[model samples]
Target chain A: DQQVKQNSPSLSVQEGRISILNCDYTNSMFDYFLWYKKYPAEGPTFLISISSIKDKNEDGRFTVFLNKSAKHLSLHIVPSQPGDSAVYFCAASGGYGNKLVFGAGTILRVKS
Target chain B: EPEVTQTPSHQVTQMGQEVILRCVPISNHLYFYWYRQILGQKVEFLVSFYNNEISEKSEIFDDQFSVERPDGSNFTLKIRSTKLEDSAMYFCASTVQSEKLFFGSGTQLSVL
Candidate 1:
């Protein structure tokens, strides 16, 4: 079963606009959530993360908000740039060793 | 910044042939993992290793697949006899204490 899900397969937005990507999970045991961005033929890069202890985390233009009660999380990029065009994956980990469960990625296209 | 590196960015093998994918995780990272993404699908966890031993593995990691930390710098995944379904991008990731993972560009394995 897919514990993590990214229902939107693709998204398009104009440059300088805010881009929001959403994710949902079924496994309540997951306590740590992360977002990764990937370009074609490249390995995914860590973008942002939030622990179960906090409801939100932000770094520069990127922010992640988690709602444990709803089992949902989202990533928001302010004034999105063309460079931000890539596939975004949401992942979760729990307990020891940090085995991750990932969502089907959302492909973001920031049009200039 | 430290990053995970994988070798032979792409590999093409005939069905039932043995294939070995190699990775070198960032030094000082305590946890190592293997994940794969089939084309147009979600990234799936394969296994996690810590303290030179496997800490956890998914049901997808069967007898045909094996992982080894041959040395301090090398972590390898071996598929004794690859099948067509084994074709996918294999990513190696490392983490320190938290659940944040740094992933390699990945090795695209195509078993014909």
Candidate 2:
């Protein structure tokens, strides 16, 4: 399904810089947006999330911005570190099943 | 912190063989879900289970696929007859209310 899409397949950023990953969704019924980080040979780990009612959510160095009007969402990592290099996936929950729909994922490479 | 656990980190089976992937979700979580990701693809929802029954399933979950919580803490996905396309990483996730899904390390299945 093309409900969620991550147009950029990869992104590179220098350490201590801001890393922004973007995602878009065609389904307006989605109310909750989530970000996940995964390393090679591992499953995705929950990073952060935002609800449609709110514009932003932050935890530690990770932040998520949601623009419901544009059907877009983004994850921002401030002062990115090498440990932050991984595949990041954007997912949405809603639209009938309480099941999550995920994007193809964007690979983030934080260069030290 | 508690984390979801999956067994058989990798499994290689012949085509048409029946395979069962097992998972143990976090204790206190009320909802369970199964997702799969083919090589270089996005994670796709397979099924959601709650209260001893499957609440929802995706179109990808066809006649050959089934899910069960045979016990209080264990959840399992069964493929009656696996095909080459079935090869992928299977992740088990649990959440409290369709929010913040905690996922396991994943079980990689290879159907030959």
TM-score of chain A of each: 0.97, 0.96
Query: lDDT tens string, model 1, A1-112?
Result: 9899999999999999999999999999999999999998888899999998999999999999999999999999998999999999999989546798899999999999
Q: In model 2, what lDDT does residue B68 have? A: 89
Residue B94 deviation, candidate 2, in Å? 0.8
What TM-score, to 2 decimals, does candidate 1 have? 0.97
Off by over 4 Å in 1: none
Tell me the TM-score that candidate 2 gets on chain A alone. 0.96
Per-prediction DockQ: 0.75, 0.62
Classified by CAPRI criteria, candidate 2 counts as medium
On a 0 to 100 scale, what is the lDDT of residue B111 in model 2? 98
Worst-scoring 10-residue span by lDDT in model 1 chain B: B93-102
The 10-residue segment with the lowest total lDDT in model 2 chain A: A92-101
